[model samples]
Target: MNAQAFPPIPFLDLKAQQARLPGLKARLDAVLAHGQYILGPEVHELEAKLAGFCGAAHCVSVSSGTDALQIALMAEGIGRGDAVFLPAFTYTATAEVPLLLGATPVFVDVDPRTFQMDLASLEARIATVKKAGALRPRAIIGVDLFGQPADWAGIATIAAREGLFTLDDCAQSFGAAQGGVRLGKAADATATSFFPSKPLGAYGDGGALFTQSAERAALYRSLRTHGEGTTRYEVLRTGMNGRLDTMQAAVLLAKLEVFEAELARREEIARIYDAALKDVLAVPARMPGSQSAWAVYCVTLPDEATREAAKAALAAASIGHAVYYPRALHQQPAYQPSHDGAALPVAESLGARVLALPIHPDLSDEQAQRVAATLIQALGG
Candidate 1:
């Protein structure tokens, strides 16, 4: 079938998802009816559901994923000269939160195939940081980039050996799994986003933290609510106004009713894309013993020029496409002064070759086929 015969493709069809969710309006209306806008019953309900969904002992909902990261670090007393190791090839938020807290982010190179944090590079960076004596290796923020689980087993071993805290940046990979277990409890603390575009999104900015330790859970709760020990007037420690809104919690509850099915549908779409593009393009590699949330289905083009040409061609065909990250964290102008002039070869080189395609659950087989065929045609197949 000709790609031109298919309907217009959207990079993310939130409207289609909304259409599937019949109870969404009612959920939102309930929030409006109730006067309590902040940390209402819905918020607690959503937290419990989320925790149970991932088998986490507790869930601390927050205003956003960035705040979740900051609160987690704050709970650990990570500040000034503390090194928060993370991948260079991910969204800026992963690195930004560390700098916001006055902690230096040590950029680690990523795997060429998986686009995950390279364990070897992470260990080497930790060693270098210790040798320099300028910074203390406090934590490792292992990111589940592009919805696939990072090598948590390896990260755990390293963190244990080095006496570092493990923070799972599951901002894009909440529904992802490893070794048959879900992501929320993979690290000492896991933070996930509910940005409108994430795999499991809220109507607005929202996030949560997962932990097994009762003390950590209590600390997170207090940190998120202005450090109130027992009463709102009694301040125990410095904190932020990082509470999840009741309305957003309501929206998530409705979405959660169908989340598992939606996740399965995303996998089905990914398989279609894999079968169609793997022969001609560098499709994403499936990591062993894990499942991706399928947040973004990216492909590697030959080079910068080829990527640009393909982007133009996709535009001409009315097919939705995008570039995940045009520059690595170390290369960004804002972080240049902070970067230690480390040569992250794979991360630096990746910006020239990667392109993202439409892979939302809303995509039908015909639309996915059109996307795949259009890309192949764009690449001069």
Candidate 2:
């Protein structure tokens, strides 16, 4: 069969989303007409809508997902000599934020199947930190890797016992739920992204912080705008310029109208892949009592060589595939010194073999089945 017979698949079909959002142009036009670009009405509107969507008391919009994490940490005064524990098998942003704030990130191993922070590893790493007596265990950043909620109950219990602050990195899992509740209130402070690829993405770079406390909400507001006391010019404390733009907020507002249906579609596609590909490879494991946003659908190949073979097959079939993180954060050159030779076997192994298939709301069932068949053929399974 000619490879051209199969249509080229997109890893993320933002254009299809744009086509669905008819109000997109109207929203942009309203932004232009109002001309209150910075911290405009749309920004406030978006913040309120986002907070309500996940039952959070407050949602402070920021420049990006990284900014959301930074603002949340800054509010807690997590600086030098502080230790921030997080999973090693995630995006670089999660680990890099702590180092940027003069804190050390203790990389913990993730669950081999679920791809979430391993609670056992987390407890052991905290003990290791205490034994070293060098850094203070101040915060634990539980990342909801790939759209599934982390073990927030376990993480919360650990944080309570150890006297550490908890931060939820919900960048890819904003719409996800745990224990019948949405993710915004799962941690002490929840940070999520609205990057163009996120489940609830904006047109451009954007993010928000969610918290149930009014005090923290107020602090986040002040911190995002140069830590102002009352007026914009009066700086009460040091803070970064991390305000979300009106245009992005307008775009998000439009997208939010269809966000629920999109999330449902993503889950349906994930199920289709699950049923079709389980026998061929290690499919993504569903978390108990949880509903994921299904931001990514990653499967494990038998080995690194098999992954390469699958990649070649996917390309030949005109299908899109990607590796979430080709290298664990601890294995990265910049973080090697901080890692200090700490072994994270699960993370290291996932780096070499895991592969992400094309998963988006616009992906059809036929396309999903095609993806599975191609991978199965490639792996000779």
Candidate 3:
């Protein structure tokens, strides 16, 4: 195939996102004129809008998604031998924050289909930890994987029973909801990212934390800026430098205008992909009464060999594809201790077969159709 004949589709197209930038230039230019780049007016404006969108009382903007998690943990005072339960199937950052805070990340299996934390497994893990009488069960981090909100009601119920704080990792499912309740409002605190490729991305790295408690929100603000209570020099608590930049905040504020439209378009694209690929692959299962943001349109191939073959075929046909995570976080080098002597059949299996297809607001119907056709053809469906 001639490269010019069919231009390769990318997993994400930031250039297409750039075309929407002009709408915010006037607001951005005004910020530039004021020369107040850090903690500027736009920062509060974006935070307020995000808090309203998530139906939360407070939103604290931070430097990155990783920082958002770190701040949330700090605000909750989860540290020093505290045990934070997390799904073993998720990204490393979900578990890393706990370790960084001198806490232990207790790995739990995920629901085989939804790829979210398995509530039964989570409760079992918590009980086992308590029985051990060594580690303290302090919190649970429920990740909204592939843009679908986790079983928040179930997870939250378990957390409340165990007196554990819940942090909703909305990094991929910021706009998602279950039973009309948004992800941010589902947990004690919600953390989301704006890592350029996210559904509501900024120009660069950015993230925000949402909470309903006034005291927690105030603490998070202090944690984001090196724990300053009143003055910059006064350190009330140990904290990280996690302030979000003004420029990224400005870009996100502009992107917020069309976020709902883009979410709807993503859903349409996902439906098309699901219908076309269902016969050949295991399509993502949408839970009842839940709406996903569809951050990634992922499918599970029949096996590892078929997954590799399909990826090669997509490459040959100029279709874009990626593996959201080829390796489970528990299997990573840094998290070896957590995975030691643990057997997670579902997480390991999904890591071998899951593949993400090109999905974004910019993907045209024709492109989506082509991606579907190429996958089916590759799999000999």
lDDT of each: 0.93, 0.93, 0.89
Model 1 Cα RMSD, 1 decimal: 1.1
1-381 in candidate 1: lDDT tens per residue?
Answer: 454666778999999999999999999999899868999999999999999999999999999999999999999999888999999999998899889889999999999889999999999999999999999999999999889999999999999999999999999998999999999998999999999999999989999999998999999999999999999999999999999999999999999999999889999999999999999989998779999999999888878999998898888888888898999999999898889999999999899999999988889998888888878887777
Off by over 4 Å in 3: 1-4
Provide the RMSD of all predictions against the true structure, rounded to 1 decimal. Answer: 1.1, 0.8, 1.4
* lDDT tens digits, residue span 18-45, model 3: 7876778877887899888999999999
lDDT score for candidate 3 against the true structure: 0.89
TM values, all candidates: 0.98, 0.99, 0.97
Can you write out model 2's per-residue Cα lDDT over 1-381, one digit (the tens) per residue?
A: 356888898899999989999888999999999899999999999999999999998899999999999999999999999999999999999989999999999999999999999999999999999999999999999999899999999999999999999999999999999988999998999999999999999878999999999999999999999899889799999988999999999999999999999999999999998888888889999789999998889999878999999999999988988998898999999999888578899999998899999999899998988888888888776
Worst 10 residues of 2 by lDDT: 1-10
Supply candidate 1's per-residue lDDT for 155.
98
Judging by TM-score, tell me the better candidate of 1 and 3.
1
Q: After superposition, how far is residue 220 of candidate 3 from its true place, in Å?
A: 0.4
